[model samples]
Target chain A: MTWETVIGLETHVELATRTKIFCSCTTEFGSPPNTHCCPVCTGMPGALPVLNRRVLEFAVKAGLALNCSITRHSGFDRKNYFYPDLPKAYQISQLYLPIARNGRVDVRTQAGDKTIRIHELHMEEDAGKLAHDPATGLTRVDCNRCGVPLIEIVTQPDFRTAEEVTAYLEALKETLQYLGVSDCKMQEGSLRCDVNLSVRPAGSGELGTRTEMKNLGSFRAVARAIKYEAARQIQLIEGGGRVVQETRRWDEDRNASLPMRVKENAQDYRYFPEPDIPPIRLSEEYLDALRAAQPELAQAKRARYQREYGLPEYDCRMITSHRALARFFEALVELGVPPKQGANWIMGEVLGALSQRAMEPGDMKLTPPTLARLIALVGEGRLNRNTAVKVFEAVFDRDGDVDAYVRAHGLEQVNDDALVREACAEVLAVNPRSAADYRSGKEKAFGFLVGQVMRELKGRANPQRVNAILKELLMQ
Target chain B: MNITPELVERIADLSRLELGQEEVLETAAQLEQIAACMDILNRLDTRGIQPMSHVFPVENVLREDTVLPSQDRAELLACAPASDGETFLVPRAVE
Candidate 1:
């Protein structure tokens, strides 16, 4: 029997604010252990937490981007749990009134474009880091990451296959990057996700007993774990064994998951309103300013790239996938480069060069005006496509002068029609057999003559002009 | 409301409190009395009243997002029960 998987995600994004959520400690990652903590973040007794203003602003902007309605009045809650990573044995979170709610995002899937509904986005404090030493069997607790500002975005169970789950995540990551709130680097732990998945008969209305998988490090791991868990549940059901609700740890090495905590052992984080932190009330004017400051997101730019520049859907998607690449494309357009030509350069030559060197588009130092001048040179027949490509490689990273390189190398095309015709005549006279072959309907002979003609001109001749001149001489 | 033995046992377990049978009974009586005392406020007719999460009528007392120097690491780690100069050492636990 076919089974369907239902999935939802709770994604925690560490805000890119300068300080911690409740304290003034720097939120920088990779500091020495326990070095960035203060009395408030380390949860010293009687040390009260004062909410950071930037954290609230970042959360509101995130809510606006995701189409979530900002909760004008939201308060904090204490999620009580006793873990060594949590110094105070409680996490400051939100439950009664979250920062935002009822948002939706559109993601592209193999099936089609699907919309994932966001349940709520709430601001919270991150817990400390725990590094287990296998040798000593002791866990090292680092409080440096403690109290970092995070927004936990919870999504409705709108995902089906693992593809949709990852698609939604990619779309979400892109959106967050566009929002400029979080770095959204999964490797750096700036963005973390917990998946809640259940399986059921293909047409069943009731969901099977679900399992929680915490922190499947990468997107690939998330997909693999989802597939593995769904199969495990199906096999259990078919074997007359019931699936138990539990938190499972995904072993990336084993390619399977092992149960970590059963229902009975799971800590019930008894939540209550935090009395120390006052409820936040955002005024309409404050929200309007944030809205005004919001940049044009990747999705909107993708649409605009298609509508305004007449770019294809594929081209628009590729160019606007990253903000920097899209900006480059737009700058080229503003500099009088044809939109289609700019799109071509980005998707073809520009992206190709970066990938060849194992670099990101952001690392590219090639300015748009420089590229525009190079393209204009080709349009004016001063430099052919081959010479232009050679010039591009030399100046890609250093942002060296493209025109100077062409001039120094004498790589400019032979634009003089008289010079091209004389070279064609000389090649035909020297290779009469090939010219005879061309006159007798051998097109290969005509190509050979053109090659000779380009050689006679020291390869500076425009290939198109050479071909046209050689074909005329052969017909004669 | 009657506080059942099972409910008392669960609450004691959550708090990690160990108690004898007589102590459990005593704790249950005290908890019931506490609940009853709060029920006194339930008798008041306060319809359409917004529930207050905090006692004080204050909101949005927020601080700017700037990095203030952290307390000296050695000083902070010295207060912990155990530390290895850099991190607090906990008996190896993963959950």
Candidate 2:
């Protein structure tokens, strides 16, 4: 029997707020352990929680960008659980009424563009991180990330393949970055994903037992987990065995999923409205203001880039996929550089540098004005394309002065007519056989002579000028 | 709704409470009484009454984004059952 994979994603994105969701503790990452914690965040008794207004604003901004409907009346609920990371024994989340619902993200798949329906978006507090040491068999808890603001975006099961899931995540991350809501950095855990995958007969309307894979650290791991889990379920069904519903952890090293534990029944979270914090009442004016403040998202930016800059659809999508890259490209164009040239440099060189270093676009420190000047040097024949690329790489790493680098390196193209003529004449005198071959209608020998002149000029000769000068001297 | 012993056991398991068999039966009876009271309350004619999540009339209670210094870390760790001078030590967590 043929089986089809069904998937949904629940992504947790930490907000870029200055303070924690319900306390004044700083939400910075990678501080000394427990340095950013306080009585409120650490779950000390008699310490009350006061909501951060910035958290609400960010949640609404994200909702608006994701095409979600913001709820007028939403409140927090206490999801009761016991874990070492959650000191309070309960996490403040939303159950009955979340901040936003009924949103959709449009992702491009192999079939076509499909809209993945968002189930809900809720504001919640983040739990601390538990780092386990295998040698000591101990787990260390870091509470610096505790009580940080997070918005969990849950989507309906709309993915049929790993590609769709990845596309949806890419689109979601781009939208979040464009909105300035979150960094969406998967490596730093600013964004985390949990995938719910199930398999069913191809023509069956019934969905099979779905298992959740928790806290996939990277996109590659997400894709691999989905493929392995889908195959595992399909094989189980074919073998006349049943797939047990449970939580699984993706082992990146083993490249397989291991079941964590099997639950005979679902664990009830015992959710109740949080009594400490008041209900969130959003006004119409507040939502409208947030919508007005919303910047152009990735989709609109892609359309505008195609229409205005006349860039190819692929180039537009690639450049606009990351907000930082798009901003760099625009800054170059605003500096009077040609749009196509800016797009080419960003798509080719800038992206190549990022991938080579295993870095993101945000890690790039190269300024657009500096890059614009470098491009102009190439256009003005002061620096050839090869030398321009080298200058670009140097500036990209050090953020140094582009003009100073070119001058110090003596990379200026040899455009002097007399100099090029002397170099060409010297090459002809040494290579008499080549000159005779050119005279005897061996066209390939002429190209070899031009190469000799270029080598003699140290690759600084204006190639087109060198070609013209070599033809004139050879004909004579 | 009838509160069964099996339901009570499941809830005790979720709450991380190791309830004895006698205690499970006793808790089920008590829960049944509570549920009967809730059923009586549910029978009232309150169609027009707005459901309130809190008794207080306040909404949007918030504070400025400023951080205050926390209490002494050594004192805070003293309250835990186990500590490593910097963090609360617990049985190793398995996922």
Interface RMSD of each: 1.5, 1.9
The TM-scores, one per candidate, come to 0.91, 0.93
TM-score: which candidate is best?
Answer: 2
Error of 1 at A207 (Å): 2.1
Clashing residue pairs found in predicted model 1: none
Calculate DockQ per candidate and list them.
Answer: 0.69, 0.60
- Reference-based lDDT, residue A299, model 1: 86
| Recovery fraction of native interface contacts for candidate 2 | 0.61
Fnat for every candidate: 0.83, 0.61
A1-476, model 2: which lDDT tens digit per residue? Answer: 77899998999999998899999889988777777877888898988999998899999999888889999988999998888898898899999889999999988877898999999999999999887757567777777888999999999998999999999989999899998989998989999999999999998898889999985889999999999999999998899999988899898999999888655543668899999999888999988888889998878988999999899999998999789999999899999999999999998999999899888888788888999999999888898887788888888876878888888888899999999999999999999999999999999999899999989988888999999999999889
lDDT of 1 by residue, B11-91 (tens): 777666898899889989999998898799889988989668888889899999978999999999888888889988888
Error of 2 at A455 (Å): 3.4
